[model samples]
Target chain A: MNATLVFARKEALEIVRTWRIWVLPAIILFFAITAPVLARFTPEIVGAVAGDQLGGISLPPGTYLDAYGQWIKNLSQITLFALIIIYGGIISTETSSGTAILVLTKPMSRGAFVAVKAIIHSVFLAVLTVIGTLATWGLTAAVFGHAPADPVWSSALIWLLLGVFYIALMTFFSVLIPSAVGAAGAGMGAFVLLTIGALWKPLSDHSPAGLAGQAAALAAGKPVPDLLWPVLVSLATAAVLVAAASLLFRQKEL
Target chain B: MSAAIRAAGLTKSYGRKLVLDSLDLDVEEGSIFGFLGPNGAGKTTTLRLTTGLARPTKGSIQVLGHDARAAGNAVRSAIGYLPDVPAFYEWMTAPEFLSFAGGLFGMSGSALHDRTSMLLDLAGLTDVQTKIGGYSRGMKQRLGIAQALINAPRLLLLDEPTSALDPMGRKGVLDMIASLRGRTTVFFSTHILSDVERVCDTVAILDRGRMVAQAPIDELKARYGKEKVVVEVTENADELAKEFGERPWATAIARGALGSIEITVTDLGAAQHDIPAIVAARDSGLARLEAGEIGLEEVFVELVGGGR
Candidate 1:
């Protein structure tokens, strides 16, 4: 317990001292705030430039739903990339710089090191996700004067699970790959493969990648397509990956 | 007497290459035992095995009375290890790093705080408040020592602590090791003979994964050292060399240029009394004669064959 706390505190302080931690939150918050505003004004922007050329072409009315959809799209694509690029090197840097030797030499168990890093990252991701969601919510309500028609509870559940799955999966990848570039490459590659898999009609229900993509669908009042098995399989796979990392670390020479 | 560290028939190999081959070692409590070996002589491997960082392929190791294989945690808790290259989180300050290390040993709150402060002072890193990334090599090495001693371990393993430092830095680390002479049993591995001479009372010389010699410094010197007399003769060098070589007290004799001869003798007193008579009978005029004690470096070279 003490070891876990120590490692967590150290990791937390490391994130706080560096720029990577703030970069993700800043980028996510920027996207969250601007996403809704842009969605609300996109038609105006389109009309302003083309309005003088075309005699009259009135566009369809935009609502808070459109703004929320924009926000989700921004998060799923650009914001996830920002999160990956920022947090990808967390464990890889330690391993490459030989800092892991110092920590492992202590009385701390190998499992505790991986677990503490996972917990700290999970907390950071959760806090950032909440902040982004709240910012989008406030802007969408103010701009459109009404909340988007969706099951708020289900949307929150999906977003929270998606954030957790990404953090866990990234942590596992960071441990499996020795170099920062290798880790980031593996994570990004896996993400791309999963995203492509989700696009296939037959695999959408079983694809772990659907967790993040389905958030906007849940927010748009679409029924969830029974994703419990995928979530279960993903969480189980994350557990196994984390365990494999710990086992590899135990036998590692340095 | 309880041994602080003991390894019997310890063997370890990476793939087809054998690093430690059935080597045995016993370190007593409160003794600074120097582990001397050339590069890639398995010094780090032996230290890692004893500290529970790496397991041996064959044989047994007991540290602080715990079996290293079955009781790795217990063994680890009782020992502090410093790698050849000490690395720390660049994001952490000195105090933060020490506290984290203390917490790993189950210390917390005021107790951890007090120890961290004391260790920082002891390591001479009291004023450094910036992150470890800005620290000089010497500061990092000092902090390495501080962290290694955080738990007040029964045995401390240092793998070439001063190998990477400048002369001044090396002196500082050596001084710190010297200060802990009786507080903790230090088992440091290095090819630097002067360092061993500076602080170590017992030494074990390893060569090619085997123990060449292990004993008290004085005992090793006395056992393997050959006493010799240097004599410069005016004439009849060949006859003098033959006379000295044939003497009962002489172990070996080597003839030199300018009618000089170096004679190795088992009984110095007997040879001292009989040398003049032999030279007089051979009618060789002695110009100069000198006698001195043998040095450890010579004995080490003789035993280990001066490789590296």
Candidate 2:
């Protein structure tokens, strides 16, 4: 337990020192604020730039849901990409560069090494989600004149859960592959397959990728049908991914 | 004293290529034992087996009386290993890296504090607060030693610790290793014969994945090394070489260019007694006559067969 905590602290420090703290959350926050701002001002900006081209083509007034939809869409895509970019090499780099050998020799279990990496990445994901959420909420409230707290909270939290799942999936693939780019490729490949599986009705609400797809409806206060199954499935899958990662990492040669 | 590490019929193969043949080794507790071998002589493989970082394919290993392959693998806690090229997090300061390493070994608070400080001072890295990424190779190697000693392990395994360092850096690292002579069983491998001579009490010379010799440094020299006798006479040098060659005691004799006679003697006492009498009888002025000197480099060269 102590080894795990120590390794976890090291991983957290790595994330902070490497600018993941600034880059991931800052990018997410940038999108969080800009998404709504872009949605609220699209009409005026278009009118100013291409007024003659769009002569008298009136646009609808941006509602609370429009800003909410923009936030969810931007976050679901950009934040997902950011997550992949941020943590893609978390485990693979250590293994490849021979850094893990020194640490592994010191009475630290391989399970602790992998588990701490997953846990710390999850913690960073949680922090990014909370900060992004608050920043988006404030920007949306300022633009739309009203904040739809409940649905935005639901959507952001759900997406954030999916982010944790991505961390696990990346860790699992990173162990399976030997390099950061290869690991990210493996993860993105599996992610695409999972997204495709979300289209099947039986798996649509239970697939790990289904949560991200339902974010728009989740943020619009529209009842997202069968939300419980997807959340449960995503968490269970993440747990299994982390477990598999630990097992594979234990067997890996330094 | 119990052996710090023991291996019987230990064999390891990667795919079909055998890296370590069926080999036996023993390291006694509380000795600065040098594991000497040429590169690719399975020295690293042996260290890996002892540390439980790797498993042997065809034999058993006992480290600190525990089966290293068996459950729990707690024996690793008592070991501090510095790989040939030890790398670090590259983002951590020396003290922070030590604290993190200490925590892994369940050391914390002031106990960890004092140990880290002492080790850093020992490694001579206390003043440098730069992250490990900016450290030079020597600095990193020193820090590597510090972290390895963080847990105060009973056995320290270093793989070619001086393989790639300047003389100053190697001396510093060797001095630090020397300080742990009694407290830790230092089993380090190096191809450099001088290094083993400088610090090791006992040595095991390995060749082609097989151990050629393992004994106390002096004993190994006595067993495999022949005592050399150099006689520089004003005359009758070649005649004495021929005479000594035919004698029962001289195993080999080589006459040098400068009226010098070199002889490898089986009986040092007889040769020393006989040499002066021969020089005195010949009326040859003896400038220098030195006997009973054995060079470790000769024994190492004999064991490994010429690849330094």
Candidate 3:
């Protein structure tokens, strides 16, 4: 346990000192603040651009829900890609550069090293998710007033859980693939496959990918629909993936 | 005395290629044992197996009396390993890297801080507070040595620590290893014979995954070295060589261009007695006679084959 904590702290420090700490968070924060504001006024901007094309095309009632919806859409597409770009090299860099040999030769076990990396990345991802979500919430409320669409606390919890699950999954992929490009490709491929599975009526309730989709719906005053099974399954799947990563890492020659 | 590291018939293979073939090694406590080998001779593989970084295919290894295969964690904690190319988190400064290494050994708070500072000074990086990425190859190698000693390990495994260093860097590392003579048992692998002679008291030469010879440095030199006599002659060098060769006491004789004859004899005393009579009989005038002990390099070449 002591060695695990030591490795965890070192991993955290490495992430904090990396250039990504400045660039990744800055880009995410900019999107978080500007995404909702853009959503709130995109119709007007579009109408202005359509001047003389339609003479005038006034948009319908644009509620805070619309702004939240835009926020989720932007995050689901761009923010997730940014996350991959930042975290893709987390394990591959160490392995390729031979740095893992030095660390593994220390008193720490391979299992502890893998576990600590997962925990540190998960915590960083959760914190960034909170920052992004809260910034969007503040901006949306300022532009279109707070609405009683859905329970804010539960909705925020869902987003946080989804972020943790994705981070864990990405970390697991990083361990399974030997190269950074391969790991990133595998992670994105898995994400696409899960997204497709979520569209199927029979599989949607059990697919972890539905967690993010359901949270977006909840923010738009739509029925959350029973997602307990998906939540449980997602948590179980994340655990299994992380355990597999640990086992694979343990056998790696370093 | 307990052996710091012991391996019996250690074997490892990658696919069908046998990297380490049934190798055995024993490093006693507080001895600087040099593992010398040519490239692709399995020196690094042997170090990896003994340090618990890689499992052997068909042999058992024990470090500090802990089973390396079964109790790897325990054995690893007692060993400090420096890879051929020591790598670090590029963003971390020397102090931070050492502290992190100490923490992995379960040191905390003030203890970690003290060890970190001490190691930083020991590694001669006390004034350089820059990140490791900016360090030169020599600095990285020095830091590697410091990190390996962070846990006060019972056994230190260094894989070609000076292989990539400049002259000054190699000298610095040699001095540092010499300074740790009695403090820790060091098992370093290198192809540099001079470095081994400089700091190592005991050495084992490996060739093609097999140990050709292993012993104390002086003992090996004394056992394998041959004594030779060089006699400078003023007259009849060819005739003197023929007469010396004809003698039963002279094992071998060679005539030099400068009217000199070199002779190898099993009994130096008998040859010394017979040489004067042969010189008188052959009417050869001797100018200078010299006899000296053979050097370690000659012994090494004779034992391991000089081509490498």
Candidate 4:
């Protein structure tokens, strides 16, 4: 009934009817099905490739931990890249293409437009992440004969929180940059800075960037130092980014 | 009638280039107002400013009696705007797009449904189930108007609504605007003078970002328009044109329709009296003689210095 919800429904339909529904889901699903397979057969494949180089040496057997670890690696690198690229044009494209003019000329506020986009896209990524994590959990159990759901689920959920931060960050960049390509480029640059920031102890333990290391450690069934600060910071950062995006979009000329 | 839109000292500049310069405009609440101009004459800029899509550099614009920039979305509910090249969710069908547009205005249930159906019928897209992406230029232009009317907005701002359509498409859009004459205040901008001539009751001509002329369609034509005397001779029409050019009453002369010579006159009565004498002296048979008012095109050319 709310105007924001109405516009959000239109945006959701756009994702469903356009190529957007397939691209990110397909990428995450590709990792979900193949990460476990790759984790299981990688040792054998390596041994075969080095057949004559080794003198009857055998590699260690892969485990469910390795499967989950592979999944986390793919998510942090490949899936995160896809998410940034997919959402980079979320706000910029609408304004540049003149679609925003028509909608904003109605009763809907510019802030409502940006807020709806951020909420819908973040929720979309969250849902897909959950589905992908469940798929990986089921496939990991099948490949390794046994798998713990708690560590895998917790790790994937934390990584998803970090992914939501990127979605908000991309929304902000899209508002600041009018060109979709420029927005995506700025998002990548920020990702690089965040990745570098993860190396510092305080930043890693206190910021969203730290979630990556925490996610990998959790996937390996290892104990983490502090999950509260990183989780809180990532969520807070996402909220701040979305708010800033809304503020900037209010002044944006369509 | 009260003013539907009012702008005073409205100006817009993109960096160093000034797009609009101190434009002041007023549109009556129930008139189909046409904003006529040449290409890049800042017609679209004025529309954007009035719709609150772009802010004025050094002026104020009030829409529906509210300050457009300050009120923002609060004022927009009473206004519907269509940009020059309207973009839509290409995946949405005509009805779906209209429904989406209506939903934004908080319309729903039977109200939204009926409005969507009526607009689709008006646009002649009621049965066209194809998505907007597959629509032709004309179909898209008509659908653009349909979405803008979904809320029954009091003041509709259209920026070059029919600039990119064929004759039939232009006619369809003009007829739709004409149908809204008494129901709403239509402020449509276009360089097509004939479109303004066809459907607009009042018009303002803009040249180089300034308001050159503004009045009722008839008043603007009469104030700035030249009177014409058209004469068709059986032979030597060009010679008769030359002879008419030499007269004191003829301000300008050109070739008229059907091998006739059109003489633009300072005094219609003098030109009427002298044309037959000139034709008879040239020994040319006068097949036809007609005196009439000049069209908006001639008036636009007189004021703006060129045709669209």
Q: What is the TM-score of chain B alone in each candidate?
A: 0.79, 0.85, 0.80, 0.95
On DockQ, the candidate that comes out on top is 4
What would the per-residue lDDT of candidate 1 be over residues B1-308, giving only the tens digit for each residue? Answer: 56888999999999999999999999988899999988888998998787666789999988888877655456667778888888998888999889888888888889888999998997778988889999988788888988998998888999888876789778877887888888889999999988888889899998888888999888988999878887887788877888788888888787657657888778888888887777788777778777766666767777888655
- For candidate 4, the chain B TM-score comes to 0.95
User: Which digits, one per residue and each the tens of the lDDT, describe model 3 over residues A1-254?
Assistant: 37788788878787788885887678768877886788778888888888778666577757777777766666666777766666666677888898988988877777777777877887886787678777888777788777443543356567666666777777778787878787778778877887888788667777677877887787676887797887888788877877888888877666
Q: Which ten residues in a row have the lowest lDDT in candidate 4 chain B?
A: B68-77
Off by over 4 Å in 3: A54-56, A147-153, B228-292, B306-308
- Which whole-number lDDT from 0 to 100 does residue B187 have in model 4? 98
Candidate 4 structure, TM-score to reference: 0.97
RMSD of each: 4.5, 3.2, 4.0, 1.6
Highest lDDT scorer: 4
Query: With candidate 2 superimposed using the best TM-score fit, by how many Å does residue A228's alpha carbon deviate from the native?
Result: 0.8
Report the Cα lDDT for residue A120, model 1. Answer: 86
What TM-score does model 4 score on chain A?
0.98
Per-residue CA lDDT of model 4 for B1-308, tens digit only, reads 79999999988999988998888899999999999988999998898888878889898998889988876666778888888889998999999999899988889999999999998988889899888999987788889988888988899999889877888778888888898888899999998888899999999999988889889999988898888888889888887788789989888988856787888888999888877887888888989888999999998888889553
- Pairs clashing in candidate 2? none
Candidate 2 per-residue C-alpha lDDT over B159-265 given as tens digits, one digit per residue, 9 for 90 to 100:
88876678988898888788889899999989898988999999998888888889999998878888889888888776767877887889888776776788988
lDDT of 2 by residue, A98-188 (tens): 7888888777788878888898889888887788888888888998889879878889888888889999989888888888887777777
| Predictions in order: chain A TM-score | 0.90, 0.94, 0.92, 0.98
What TM-score does candidate 1 get on C-alpha atoms? 0.85
**CAPRI quality band, candidate 3:** medium
